[model samples]
Target: MSETRPLLEVSHVSRVIDGKTILDDVSLSLERGDLKVVIGPSGGGKSTLLQCVNFLQVPDSGDVFLDGQSAREMSRRNICEFRQKIGMIFQDFNLFDHLCARDNVAIALQKVKGQKKALARQRAMAELERVGLADKAALYPSQLSGGQKQRVSLARALAMDPMAMLLDEPTSALDPELIGEVLNVIAQLSLSGMTMLMATHQIGFARHLTKEIIFMEAGRVVEAGPPKILEPGGGGRAAEFCAKLAQVTGR
Candidate 1:
C-alpha cells in the first residue's frame, strides 16, 4: 500500500548563523495548489525560511520534504535538481542588466534545461506574455521600470516549470504606484492554482488570496491560521502587524 503526502513540508527546521538563531524549529506544510502567506516584523525569519525551503541556505538542523522526498538526503547534484523544482522570485528583481527581458527568461532554460536556443526563446516569449510583458521582451533591465523588471524575474522562474514557488518580499522593493501590478500577477497565479509560499507585508492580498497565513517572530512560528487570525483585536504580534499594514494600506 502507498500513501500520498504534502507537496511541500518543512519540519522542525532550525538555522543559526554566527551564534544568532535565524530560524527556530519552524514547520509548515503545503498541499498542491496551496497558497500560503508568511508575514512578520523584520528579523522574524520569514525570509530565512524561504531560503531554507529553496536550499539556498541550508538549515543547521531539520528536514524539508518536497513532494514527499527528503531534501536532507540529496547530494550536491541532487540538491541542484531539487531546487529546479522549487522556483524563487526575489525582491531585488535580480535581472542581468546586459540581458534583454527575453534572454533573462530564456537563459536558464537554455543553460540548465539544455534546450536549444530557438526552443528556449519560444518558451521565454510565452512566459513573458503570461506576465503581460511580451512586448517588453526586447527591452533591457535598465529600460524597464521596477515592476516590469520584477515581472521578468517572475517569468524566469516560471520557465523552470517548478512544482512550487518561494517568493521573498516579491513587491517590497517596488514603488508604491508599481506594487499593484506585480501583486496582480501574483494574485492571478494564486487563482490559477500555483502552490506558493510568500513572505510579504501585503496584508490586503493575504486576506483575499491566501489559504493560510503564518506569522513568525524572533525566529519562531508564533502563529499560523486562516486570515481571520488577523481580525481586529486579534491577539499577538501577527495581529499587530496585520493591523498596522491595514492602516498603512487603508484596507
Candidate 2:
C-alpha cells in the first residue's frame, strides 16, 4: 500500500432492522494515515456504521472495501482476517470481570496470534505501560476506576497493533472530569499518527484531533470536509449539531 491509497472505501451501503432503514446508500473513503471523526445525533446510526465496517453487523446492501477488496464478499475466515487489521474500542469497557487487565489484553493475542503465554504476557504488560496502567495490570475490572478500565480497554485494542482503529463514543460512560484522561490517551494516539475513525461528541477535541469530520443523520452521511470547514455555526444540520456539541465542550 502506497501512502496515498485509501485504506477503506464504502459505496451505496444500506442496512435495515425490522423494515426500518438504518443506513441508506452510504458512501465513504478513508485515506491511509488520516484521522477521521464521525459525529451525529442520537439514533443517527454512527455506531452502526462502524459495526458494518468491522462486519459485526452485516449491511443489507451495497459494498464496503478494505484495501480495495469488498468486505461484503469476504468469507467468514476472511472476515476474521480483516478484523485482525482493525481494532475497536467501545464506550463501555468490555473487559472480562473475572479476568485481570493483563489477562484481558493477553487473551486476544493468545487466541488471535497463537502466541505462547510468556510472549503474550510480555506484550500485554508493555501495552498496559503504554496506557499508563503498568501497576494496575494485575487488577480486575471490578477493582479499577472507570477511566482506568477504559485505558485498559485501549491497551487491549493496541496490543493487536491494528492497521486502523474504530472508537465508538469511548468516553461517554465516564464522569465529566474523567473524560479528559481517556481523551488524553486518544490525543496522544492521534499525535503519534494512528489511523483512526472515531464516533464522538467531543467537538473541540475532535476538531483538533482529526483531519476530517463526517456528519451522519438517519444512517446516511450528510457531510464531510476539513474540520475548519465544519466548526460550530458553519451551516446546515451539521453546523447545528456542532453548535450543540460545542456548548457541551465549552467551545
Candidate 3:
C-alpha cells in the first residue's frame, strides 16, 4: 500500500438487515496513525459500521478498503488472511476462561501466524508489556479484574501487528472504576500511533484524546468533526446529543 493512501476507507457503504436500513451510505477514512471515535445512542448503527469494516457483517452495497484492498473482493480463504491485518476488540473481553492471559494472546499467534510455541509466547509477553499487563500474563481471565481482562484483549489484538483496530464499546462492560484503566491503555495505543476506530458513549473521554469524533444517529452520520461538538450550544443535533451525554456521564 502506498504511504499516501489511507490505512482504511469506508466508501459510501450501506447495509440493510431484515428490511431495515442499518447503515446508510456511511463513508469515513482513517489515516495510518489516526485515532477516530464514533459516538451515538444505543442502536444508532455504530457497531454495524465497525463490523462491516472488518467484514464480519458484509455491506449490501459499497466498499471497505483496508490498505487499498477491498474486503468485498477477497475470496473466502483470502478473507482470513486479510482480517489478520485488522484487529477487533469487543466490550465482552472474550478471553477464554481456560487460558491464561499469555496463552490467550499466543494461541492466535501460533495458530494463525505459524509461529513456533516459544516465539509466540515471547511475542505475547511483549504485547502484554506494551499494555502494562506483562505481570498479569500468567493469570486466568477469571482471576483478573475487568480492566485487566480488557487490557489482555488489547494485548492479544496488538500481538498480530495489525495495521488498524476496530473497538466496539470497549469499556461498556467494565465497572465504573475499572473504566479508566482500560481507557488508559487505549490512550497509550493512540499516542503510540496505532490506527483505531472506536465506537463509544464516552463523550467526555473522547474530547481530550481522539483525533476526530463522528456522531452517528439513525443509521447515518449526523455530525463528523472535531471534539468541539461537546461544547454547550454547539447546537446541531449532534452537539445536543453530546451535551446530554456529558450531563449523563458527568464527564
Tell me the number of clashing residue pairs for each predicted model: 0, 0, 0
Q: Sort by lDDT, best first.
A: 1, 3, 2
**Root-mean-square deviation of each candidate, in angstroms?**
1.4, 1.5, 1.3
**TM-score of predicted structure 3:** 0.96
**Model 2 C-alpha lDDT versus the unseen true structure:** 0.87
Query: lDDT, candidate 3, residue 153?
Result: 94
Residue pair clashes in candidate 1 = none
Q: For each candidate, what TM-score against the reference?
A: 0.96, 0.95, 0.96
Which pairs clash in the backbone of model 2? none
Best by lDDT: 1
Q: Which window of 10 residues has the lowest lDDT sum in candidate 1?
A: 1-10
- Model 2 agreement with the true structure over 18-39: per-residue lDDT tens digits: 9999988888878776789899
lDDT (C-alpha) at residue 6 in model 3: 94
Model 2 TM-score on a 0 to 1 scale: 0.95
Candidate 2: which stretches are off by over 4 Å? Answer: 247-250
Better model by lDDT: candidate 2 vs candidate 3: 3
Q: What's the residue-level lDDT of 69 in candidate 2?
A: 81
